[model samples]
Target: MNILFVHGNYPAQFVHLAKALAADGHRVVFLTGRKDPEVWPLTGVEVRRFELHREVSSEIHPYLIPMEQAVLQGQAVLRVLDVLAQEGFQPRLTFAHGGNGLSLFIRHLFPETRLIAYMEWWFRDETSHWCFPSYEFDQRLRTTMRNSIILQELEQCDVAVTPTSWQQQQFPKHYKDKIKVIFDGVDTSFFCPTPVKGELILNGLKCVQPLHIGENSLLLTYATRGMETLRGFPEFMRMLPPLLEALPNLEVVIAGDDRCVYSQAPDRADGSWKQALLEELGNRLDLGRVHFTGSLMYGEYQQMLNRSDLHVYFTRSYVTSWGLFQAAACGASLMVNRDPATNYVLKGDQAYWVDLDDPQHLVDCATKVLKSAPERRKNIKQSYLKSEWALGNCIASWVELINAQLKV
Candidate 1:
């Protein structure tokens, strides 16, 4: 089958799926923004750059910025699709990330093409408007207008795939029947426990160690883009002081790029709310004990997970993080913030649940897992490995779903 994958970044969610489909001899081509020219070299996938006039702006209203960016990018995508059509390049199926407007135009251009959108999230109740508080006054009024536009695009798709049932449930009642849940697979082979592994010697402290019987060192890790308030960053920071006071041996690692995504420029002031959090933590920051390894490479990330005694994943909403799945695959016992969306992915004894609103609960839940008996920890880790959450199995299932849909 000839497949055209569309996203702002090539192969973002379709990383493994694109490779899998290419290996099976399907023709895979990607249309993405003008960054990272060599993203998928070995997948036998071809990339077409979509050039847009404007960069994503942070000064304008946050809501308007992404919308304007998407429309501009969509125009670029349409131009590329037009060239492809002129060259007689027609795909049997089209897969796109729904947030972008490219798919809507693609459906109009190629009415016969079967379209499937990977629905990451949709704004429903007031809870979905967490990004900006000021936007709340006009959020529902704006969201209703935006939802109409969004639904028009989504309704054109033949099918919709979501990473979790929680995300699928976010769609309107009419679209719920069309949504299918498939995980964004993790690389289990790379994430598993490695014996005799030396501690991650970061900033002079040997914090990470392999699981050795009777070893009581507690390693806790939290990773993401940065310390964004909506991502529970402020709460994590608020909880840190109390946690540090309670557990002396506990070593915490915060990983990710410190730079704010929506910041105007690189040299801008660093006195954001996130920076203030770091300042307040002050002497208790424990440079040697609490490491901040900013934005690690994939291999280093896996190693960090492998070395963790417990992984704490906190999010204000239902958006699932690939890092959490990777940590679970690495056999690190996970303590996740409780949400309806998270409950769909993590279940039974697979993870310890915590309330997102309660900072003390986050610390307590993580501490409980950290202080658990070695045998109990080992059992939870092993159970996580065997669960449906494994990356390899998840990838296989995604391939099967795509293949079945394309066959129709």
Candidate 2:
């Protein structure tokens, strides 16, 4: 079967699925706005880059900018689809992400093509970032308005896919039947635990290295695509000083970019959350022990997760991060929040949970994990192995779902 995949960030959640289809001798083509060839390079798939020409009008209201940008993206994708259709490249099915409005006008171009919309997250007035402590009323109002695009795209899709049941339940009851629960999957083989050889590598160099596993050194890791409050970045930073002071052997490695990819997070005069934490914590923090390794390559990230003594992950009731699953796959001990979003993946017995409202709780959890024996970390990993989110298992599920979708 011929398949067309559309995503602003192509091959993101669809990487395993796309490659699996290509391996099965199916012709797979991806239409994406992503320009980073390094990131989107798939050996068997044909990739086409689409450009957005319409810039946000200065005269337009601030609240309308998001909707306008999405509409422009939809327009750009529509143009690419038209070209593909003219070239006799009509796909039997098109998989798109509803979050970015990519599939908004796809049906108009090819009414017969079945479309499966990927519902990553739904932006609602209340459940979204509005629930965050620092969210503003104006931002909430704008977000509520911005949700129309997703609603429209969801309405148009033949079916929808969500990585988690928690995320699928976020949609309205009317749309629940169409939203299938599927995990993006974790590569357990690549992320397996490594014997601590008493060293850490960063960009091919070891600056903040640990010599011994438990006696002379400690390895704690936290990672996200971005450093933001939704993932508990600020709160994590607040918890760090106490942990650093309590455990002198501690070495914290934070992997993420400075920008907030999800929503606007609180920033300092210099506009960096990291710098703000540095200023607030001041001499209280052992800066020398902290290593901020901004976004890493996939191999590097897996290696870091494998070496981590404890992987700390905290998130709101919103979308759960892929990092959590990766850490679990790596057989690393987890320190996660007790929020319902995380409970779906990390059971209470599988991970150490702390009350997100209290920064002290986070510190306590970290200390507890650090003090625990190194052998105990395997429990969390064992629990994750039972999950169907393992790489091959997830790809098999996707293939089954796609086959069913293609059935006449």
Candidate 3:
């Protein structure tokens, strides 16, 4: 089988599947954006980086920024596919992340090939619009227009794949039949709660005094790619003072960068959202016990999940985060937000759900979860192990789907 995976970032959602196919003797090649060659050294897989021929104009409408960027990047990918075709290369199947328009026009290039756009989210005129609570008429109009790019790509691709049912439900009813709900499975073996026997160190910290996690201390972990409003970082920070005040031995480890990934909340005139929180909660929080590991290595992150007494994950009624699944896989007692229709993972005593609007309730819920015995939280971990989202299972399902598409 000749398989080609396309994503601007190398091996993002396709990592496990690509590696598995290559190991199974399938010819696997990746078309990625300009990334460091040394970073991706996957054996049995060929990696090729494509360069954008042009850039999105600065004077273009602000609403069309993402669409414009995707067009440029998509053109670059098409050029690479053209070169490969000239060299007698034809992929039986191609998988791409729909956010970028990489697979938007692939059908025109290789009519015989099967292209599956891995649709994460389709930002349409809905309740989950980015400019919520502070919605502006102009912003809403802009968002409505942003769907053009996604709609065009959705039509161009042979099929679509979404990681969650909530995400798949976001698509229009007409396209629902063609969309498949397949999660990017978690590697339970690497993420399991095998207690670490040694001390762990975080990035941007001196090694002279490495932090000894999972020691005789009550640990609470909150992790995300960016500490932005979409993930409810601001409210979580505000609730932390009361939580820290309640538990004297509690140690909080926050893992992420100080950048805004979502939301149009104006940054503080002086610094970031994190800095603003630090200023507002000065002396109120136990500074010694609160550690911020800017970004962590995979090993460090796994240890944080496995070692924590309780892991807190909060998100709006939007796309779900992979961190929640990873936390569950690591056997951590989960404290998550109740987003009603969006959060389907908190059923059957798997996680403690808190109200999205109440900071006091969050503090009370987390504090109680921290005090609860580890034996009571075994259900959360056991539920995850028995699920269908394990890495091997997802890869097999993905291969089967691709093979089925090729047959047609």
Candidate 4:
């Protein structure tokens, strides 16, 4: 069987599924805008690189800019598609990650092949997105326009899938039935707890040199791809000073780059939220015990998770962060923001939750958990194995879903 995949970033969410297909003796062709193949080279999958030869005009209206970018991306992908079509290549299935317009014209060429869209999220309303406010009419209009491409793809595709129930619920009521919740499974065995915990090593961030956490040191972890307000970086930072003052033995290990993706820059010269927060809480924070390691390798991350006395995470209502789930898998006790998404996985005594509005409450919760929550580590692991969200189980379901679509 010939299977085609369309993603701007190759193997973003398709890592496990693509490898599974290739191992099953299927020819997997991937179309991506990723320039460097060495970064992630799947053994059997053939990756085709597409170049965006044109750019969206600066003069274009703000609301139309997103669609313009998608159209340009779609045109670049179309060029690649045209070549494949001429070469007598007809895939049995085309799996596309929606949001980008790359796969917008895919079905036009391969009319017989079934198209399946990987639905991440749709900006259903202002409340659904953490950054937007419902009262902001202009921003809401722009967001509604942004969803046009995704809606088109969703309407046309044979199947559409979102990673979580929360994300699935974010779509329109009419389209809710069309979207299925298929989580991007977590590898429990790989992320499971490590028994050895003696020393902590941080690869080092550009802004902060890492501090050492000895054998007896109590470690607190915060991991994310970027230090953004949407994920509660600022609120988390505010809790750090007071939490450190309370516990002298506590050592902090922060994992992630000092970049913002979902939120605006801080009101500072450098615009780094990390730098701004540090400046804001300057002498109050004990620099000796706090460590900031930009982006950790998997081995380092796993070790930190295992060693973490309390792993603090803060994500908005609809957004899903894999780091939290990994922390859960590693039996890391969580101190997270109070949101339905986090509450979904970490409930009851599994995690220590606090609202972003009250930094003092976060400090209070962390202090209590650090002093007493020894058994809470195991509590989260039990519920979160989401046995259904386990890699093997979900992969099997993916195979079944893909094969089922092929038959239709």
Candidate 5:
């Protein structure tokens, strides 16, 4: 069987499942626009690349810019498909990400192939957006227009899959029947809590000497891909002043880049939200206790999680970060902002929840979690993810879905 995986980035959501399918004796080909294909270490799978042939027109309306870019990307994907078709490689099934316009033309080219879309998000009117101005005509117009490619994929694909129930809920009610909620599983084994072999060394990027984990020091970790509004960094930052002031021994390790990957840019002319917060909170923020390690490597990240006395993961009504699960896997006590309705990583008594409107509540929760007993801090070992969102189980689920789709 020939299986194809398509995404803008290489080995993203399909990282674990792609390798699993390849090991199952199926020929797996991953088509991506990732700049560096060799960065990923995939043994059995083949990686292919495509580049956009044309640039988006500057003359077009700003609202249509995304749609235009996606159309060009669809053209690029079609060209690659034509070459693959020439090589007599007709994929039995194609798993393509729905966000990018890459999957737009797959159904048109391969009529018989089962094109399953991995729909991460479905943009609608501004009401669907969390922080964006819902009443503004332009924001609402752009929001509705952003779903052009996604709606196309939803209309064309055999089945669409979302990682979380929240993500699935974002789509239109009429198309709800066609969507499936399948979590992109986590590798619990690597992320699990085991004693770090030696001293935890956070490789210093800004500082001269590497920061080693102190035995007596307490770590309150806030880990994310980017320190943006999407992951509730500002709220986390606001809590820090009061938190560090209250707990003298506690040190907050913020692990991520200071860039806007998901959310809109800051209103500040400098365009950095972190900087904006620093200016806003001026002397209130405790600079000494706050450690900003700009994007720790995977090993350092896991070690940070392991050393965390309490992990803080706060976000708006958006997709939950993978760090949330990693923190859980590492057995660190959680301080989540969102409710149980969206955040399935931690349940009742397993973690702490705080309100978005109440800044003091966030500080209060952090202070309490840090003050709690060490034994009481760690939670939810191999039970939850092991049964549900573990890598093996999710792979099995993908196989089951594929088998059902292909009918043996």
Candidate 6:
């Protein structure tokens, strides 16, 4: 089967799937706007890059900012499609990452091609309005217009894939029937618990605590794109002051780069609530205890997760982060907010549930995990292993799902 993968970045979610398909003797071609073309090179896969304009308005108006982004992305897609036609490369099936305007253009260019869109989010919920809250006053009007574009793309696709059931359920009733759930798998090899080398310098303190087989550590980790609002960074920061008072030795390490993740709009600049909370905690919380490692390479990220005793995974709405799965794969006891999406992946006694809006609850749950017995910690680790959230298993499942959809 000839497959063409379309995404702003080359091999983003399709890395493992692309390799598996190529290994199975299928031809694959990737169309991406990634600056580093050398990053993707599979034996049976060819990659092409298209220059994309990614500028956005720094204005206070939320609607204008996103509108600017959409326009730039749409223009980029049009250019890529023209190049593909001239090159005479027509793929039998096209896989696209939904939400990007590229998928809609693919449908327009190849009207007969069977396109399967990876539907990460539908932006249909009321909470979706909160994602761009600066436009809240005109949310109803904006949502209707934005969703119309998404629905049009959905109509063009032959099928769609959703990572989690929570995300799939968010689609319109008519489109839900065509959506299939296939989770983004973990790489268990890199994420599992390993021997610690030296004291990792967090904030300023040198934490050298060891996990004796089943014992938990005084460390807590939150990894994601560092947007203060979207990933609940502000709420996590607010809960930290009280949490530090309760557990002084407790260290919080936030991973990911701020520039790439956080919006730079003038309105969003004031979203530095995390820095403020850290300042208030001051030396009382151990200035060295709150560490931000910026963005880490994949290897370093997994190593940090391996060192964590407890991982705090919080999000405002339904979207799930890959960090949550990687932490679980590493056997880190997780404290997640009560959300339907996270509930599906972590169940029973494996995860502690907290209300995202309640800072006190987050503090209490962190304390519980820190004080839990080694035996209890061991049980949680076993639960993660038993659920087959391991990387190898996840990769295998992904291969099966994509292959099943192939027209072979």
lDDT of 2 by residue, 1-408 (tens): 779999988678889888888888989998888888466578789999889987878998988887888889899999988898899988898999787778888889888888999997777655676345465888778777777888888889888899988898788888888899888988777766655454656662233443223434678888988777778888889988888888878888888887777656564565577777788889988877777777777887887777777888988878888888888777677888888788888656777878888877778778988977455644444435446888888888887888798785
Candidate 1, position 198, lDDT = 47
Task: Tell me which residue pairs clash in candidate 2.
Answer: none
TM per candidate comes to 0.84, 0.92, 0.91, 0.93, 0.92, 0.82
Give lDDT for model 6: 0.68
> What is candidate 4's lDDT per residue for 100-135, written digit by digit as tens?
898888878889988889988778554445763232
lDDT, candidate 3, 1-408, per-residue tens: 788899888777888888888998989989989478547578798988889988899999988987888888888988998998898889988888886678776777888888888887777655546435466777777777667777887887888899878888888889998898888999988988766544445553322355665455678888987777778888888878888888877888888888776664455574477887888899997878888877777888887777777888988767788888888787777888888433676565777888869888888888788877445434444435447778878877787888789789
For model 1, the local distance difference test gives 0.70
Across 163-253, the per-residue lDDT of candidate 6 in tens digits comes to: 7778888888887778877766666666676644556433212224431221234677788766456677767776666666777567777
Better of 4 and 5 by lDDT: 4
Question: In model 1, where is the ten-residue run with the lowest total lDDT?
Answer: 204-213
Where is model 4 poorest over a 10-residue stretch in terms of lDDT?
376-385
Candidate lDDT values, in order: 0.70, 0.79, 0.78, 0.81, 0.79, 0.68
Candidate 5 vs candidate 6: the TM-score winner is 5
Q: Give the runs in model 6 whose Cα sits over 4 Å from its true position.
A: 37-44, 53-72, 132-135, 193-217, 246-248, 259-273, 279-285, 373-380, 383-408
lDDT of 3 at 233: 85
Error of 2 at 190 (Å): 1.8
Regions of model 5 farther than 4 Å from truth: 124-127, 131-135, 196-199, 204-208, 340-343, 373-386
Better of 1 and 3 by TM-score: 3
